[model samples]
Target: MIARLARQLGKEERDLQVLEAVLEHQPIGITRIARETDIDEHKARYSLRMLENDGLIEPTPDGAVATDDVEERVREINDGLDDLIDQMESLKDLDG
Candidate 1:
């Protein structure tokens, strides 16, 4: 089975919303993320748990500390998608 290392990248609308809120307010809690995102606390907690499991974030004595390199990870995803777009464009030449 292929480990979907990019779970959030696809089913991420909700997760992205939560991540953005967390990034802006690191060491925050599910209650805060829930309030800001209008998501229920349970959903917010689930998103945080998934992100933490992927090493994309963490929880500490203080609170949830988003991964320091989350932006970097986002960049990497963008770069990969850009590369994919370039590849697909190349294939369009054959269709035309």
Candidate 2:
């Protein structure tokens, strides 16, 4: 179960990297994002689609930009992941 969750989240992590790239370089194109982030153009496009579907980013003629909602949601998700890490650390004793 944990392995499955990790696999799922690994994809999300990549997507987040793409989102970060877009946010950092607002109004940039897909090809440029791929070059900047060292991701394949196809993978970058997939990430963009996911971000768009989730309302985290919007398309501009030049490229893409993070939505206002993205910053807030990114904060929330970061906090939640921090909490998850703490919980996982707590489990170490149980395993021992």
Candidate 3:
């Protein structure tokens, strides 16, 4: 279970990396996103699709751009991660 959670978190991290690249460079393409984030082009493309589906980003003739909802979604994600961290801390306390 822990390993699965770790993998999920890693994927989330990678997706966020791709999102950051797009946020920094609006109208950015998958190839440039891969280069900027050091992620595989396929992986970046996958992340872009995921983000678009999540309404965090949109694709244009130029490239992918962050949506207005990006900031709100990021805040929710951060809050969820904080909650996960707290749960993990509680788990650690179980051994004490």
Q: What number of clashing residue pairs does each candidate have, in the order they appear? A: 0, 0, 0
**Candidate 3 or 2, higher lDDT:** 3
Tens-digit lDDT track for model 2 on 13-37? Answer: 8899899898899987889889988
The lowest-lDDT stretch of 10 consecutive residues in candidate 2 is 87-96
| Global CA lDDT computed for model 2 | 0.88
Residue 15 of model 2, lDDT score? 91
Q: Across residues 1-96, which tens digit of lDDT does each residue of candidate 3 receive?
A: 889988998988998998999999999999999999999999999999988988999999999999988899999989998999999899988953
Full-model lDDT for every candidate: 0.79, 0.88, 0.93
RMSD of 3: 1.6
| Candidate 2: Cα lDDT at 30 | 85
Q: Give the runs in model 2 whose Cα sits over 4 Å from its true position.
A: 1-6, 90-96
| Top-scoring candidate (lDDT) | 3
* Model 1 poorest 10 in a row by lDDT: 1-10
